[model samples]
Target: MSLDFKPGAFSDFFRDETFRESFTYRNSPDAIRRFPFPFDRDEYMYSVNMEPHVPGRKGSVFEKTFDVDEHYVSEMIDRAKVLADDPLRCQSLPHMTLAGWDTLELIMEAKARDYPQWFSLTKEGDRWHWINRPLGIDHTFTFLDESTLPYGPFEYIMRQTQGDWTLQDERDGTLWLDAGVATSQADWSADFDIGMNFHEWHAPVPLAHDLGVFDRALKFLLKLQHGSPVRRFNWTMTVNPLLDTSPENYPKWGPTKTTLTQENLGRKQHLRVELQSLYRLPRSNAIAFDIRCYLGSFEQIVTVPKWGRRLHRIVRDLHPDLATYKGFIRNRPAMAEWLSKYDDGAPTSPGWWPED
Candidate 1:
């Protein structure tokens, strides 16, 4: 689990168009090997779909609890580029400074536990030291002093980890999105969502509000425990390999909705699976929503016969409202056709695939 990321690994990754192009293909085995394929049934629906983070899952290339995979360094580099392009992607309210420190401590501890060789943390009195060998970051800072860390406490933590994090504060029996960083949002805007309650933030989701899914989710999130982290998987399709698909950059990627055709469907379309984890900070009474995105194409998905057939059926049968909300109305038909052409006509049942 210990990866030695060279000093310029990220720069090298970004500069190499050929290396980046490798992942954009439909039959990239490397992508499929690590893909968090999100469908389990022919029909997809909204649900609470959370469970305790169990380690050593069989299908995924990385662990479910806290994973640092091959894309760790590259993705962090992508995050930095996005944040530089727009600092608004990372925000923490002044009152949430303490919560920010708590998040940093929690993430550092998790990194050390999961990848001890590459990451470590040590504390002596109020002075704490964090060492991230891969990033060549070694610094000592006062646990709660904003001046000691170059960036906001939460921002500093986000730089070292692969997942984008959001901290929700619990107040008056409700959870509010008080602080955190997000560079890889599905189509939502973290800046616009700040200060909104769980239900308000998820308002755009198709049937969650009508079916009381978000209400039940909010209740479950508020009752989450400190040691036990729960995770759920959500998926959407994007036209590009890029991760910064927030509403702000919609103009850049939004047009791809109508541009997809059977000719380019396999190479242009990607299934984006988000591994979202919810953790209750021990000290701040805040919930940390960590999102890690995994992308794969129909070419790679079809390699697994069941995944191909299931995805074809799901897209073909998806409710119109849900498909529209997911920004798939214009392109899904083309994608379904491409998937069907590649499918091997495998027999699949609803219970065949495991839930994330």
Candidate 2:
């Protein structure tokens, strides 16, 4: 059986006055624009498209090291729901305990510095105080003490932040998936991939491994500097506004991808983009990979004429195997057709849209 999607209902969320108002930074010079639309051209191929995490680079408003967007609270709530339903969605090996602590401290410090109003961290002797104003969480605990944070260091960090993170330890000339919490995965199992080498975990990716992209990425990651982080972009299609698309919940979301048709394409299909950041923790020397998921529907994305047409072109030119790997092969044709409506060759203004 297939799930039904109502275009009117789905479009309402994107068109809501309150929801659109949440995009307060849309016109600001420093506003991190929505839709870091990854396609550079009509033909899409994978590559190690990474750059230094310098703020305001290339005239971009993503001026902060960590991104805390309007969806932070809602996404964190969804993550908590997923973790409660399946504890395995958040796991860290015993060896990664310290790495987990390092990750927690790093993110907390970043959040406190970047968003001082909502998050604050202070230390008095060996005791640390973490204040999450948004969540109404205020607690004092011994720094690095497991008992101090009942949910564990990584899980505690995951609760306050928006993105999912993974700690990678460099050893034996390879990166190991040692620890961290991943609640919003793109059809991948963090629990299953735990303890796997970088290459082993990404073995299923078609040409990236064979083309030595992963090998080169590992080398680049290992040489990454402590304070200087780098970021990259990846994208796929999702059928819902849901964030917890990990393989553990595939039984629930996998069928929705197959349910896409011309009738429901505009409402059910969403362009899911991941703003992936790589940080080298100064303390543990562990590499922290953060995945921040962003979703926009065809209706919202079409507001930006360039993004709409570019997305249509990329999907039209997408390789069959690549589309299949991304779990969208079954409905790519319908999606392409639907996207064509917005590709009327209108002169694009090359500006950002709030909804996108």
Give lDDT per model, in order: 0.76, 0.73
lDDT by residue (tens digit), candidate 2, 1-356: 11111122212112221111132211112222445666665577889989887785333326677766555555665667677788887888887778888887888887899879777999898799887766667788888788877777887777777777888988898889888577777888888988999889999999777778998988888899988889888889888666777788788777777777788777667788888899888767888899887777776676666878877878988888789999888888899899999787654443333333
> With candidate 2 superimposed using the best TM-score fit, by how many Å does residue 312's alpha carbon deviate from the native?
0.5
Candidate 1 residue pairs that clash:
26-299, 26-300
Clashes of each: 2, 0
TM-score of 2: 0.86
Task: State the lDDT of candidate 1 residue by residue for 47-137, as single tens digits.
Answer: 9999787674554634635776656666776777788799998998877888888888878887888779778889999898888876767
Which pairs clash in model 2? none
Misplaced by over 4 Å in model 2 are 1-33, 57-61, 346-356
CA RMSD, predictions in order: 3.9, 7.1
Model 1 Cα shift for residue 80 (angstroms):
1.2
